[model samples]
Target: MHQALLVPEVLLEIFAYLSIISYTQTTSTQKLLAALARTCKIFHEPAMYLLWTEIHGLEPLLGCVTRLHPLIYHSGTWWDDSDEPWTKGVEPLSAHEAHQFLRHSSRIRTLNIKSEHPHLLSVIPAEACVFPRLKSLSLSTTYLNLFLPHMLHRCHLLSVDEGLQSFVTRCIALEHLCIYTPHDVHGTANELISDRIHWCTRVVTLSCPILD
Candidate 1:
């Protein structure tokens, strides 16, 4: 009985210190935490904050919503093509969920919206967004050309589409922009990433396709 009471407390402290990414590496851990969280309100707070803050998995996220109430954290969820458990059924980015996320925009200081999901553009609002602490905005989307001119300053890793030599018009407070292009899709000009952009002449790294 003594160990049982102490176990959850121990887990809570340990979980609070661990990085958000580690929580999703093992599906079993996620399920375990979810189970513990459901046991009482105490477990729920950490489970939701620690887990939802850094979301990298879908199944666990889906499970989270089912167990917990609607979340308001702007978890830096980076769902690129490299991610796994790619169940087509999830469609990870949905309009319904987007609203849930946006509603809590204040809670989300840093958001990572990858370019892998072309449809995600529709789910997110363009201008007039208010994220007080939002210092980093990472966008890896198919609609880079459309949103870049507007939201680049909101993020550090500004992922773009195509390696086009466009003039760095306005990317104040920008840092670490990544342009992604797959091997098979060479010359296809998918995404371009320009980094280290801030109000001043911050170091910027621009990635584009080399025309050989």
Candidate 2:
């Protein structure tokens, strides 16, 4: 092995570059990191850290809880209908499973959930802050109630209202928020959001949908 590769900083920079390049390639960055993670113990932590730094969906995080394996497999098709039977008969995570879930969840810095998956609500650990190091989040309205308790620095929201209020009051670290409402916001809803925004001075950047 090369001497420079022995240095953690050098390895991280090299891996970081690989992550950027993979964005334009057919191969994903996570695949490359996953390979490095399995290569040796020295490469494992950094590789896994970068791999879990930013995640597109909750499945990868939820997969850590061994009890949820069966539930996650159905997630690909589960987003279509909230009333689906798949959400039924589900079990909550055991204390040990919740600890396992937190181990990986703590690594996620950015999380984006495109659609709502109700099963997560039933399976998520009751921890107050699942993603302790999370800095950015992108979520559908369906997820607002599920994830609002976690603090974040930046957020992108698909729907708005009480969810918006939760973010304002609970996410004291929040500096940026972008909201896109599928339907135009009107009446008291507009005033309520505006008032909340006025009270939360920590937010430096905010983009809200056109008010009616």
What Cα-based lDDT does every candidate model obtain?
0.43, 0.72
TM-scores of all candidate predictions against the true structure: 0.43, 0.78
- Which lDDT value does model 2 have at 48? 87
Runs in model 2 deviating more than 4 A are 20-27, 70-89, 123-127, 141-151
Q: Which lDDT tens digits does candidate 2 get at residues 66-117?
A: 7776676654443333445444566665667767766777778889886445
Clashes of 2: 0
lDDT of 2 at 83: 43
Put down candidate 1 lDDT per residue, 131-194, tens digits, no spaces. Answer: 4434455555443343344234433333334322321554444554444445455333432322
Count of clashes, each model: 17, 0
**Which candidate achieves the best lDDT against the true structure?**
2
Worst 10 residues of 1 by lDDT: 65-74
Q: After superposition, how far is residue 88 of candidate 1 from its true place, in Å?
A: 8.6
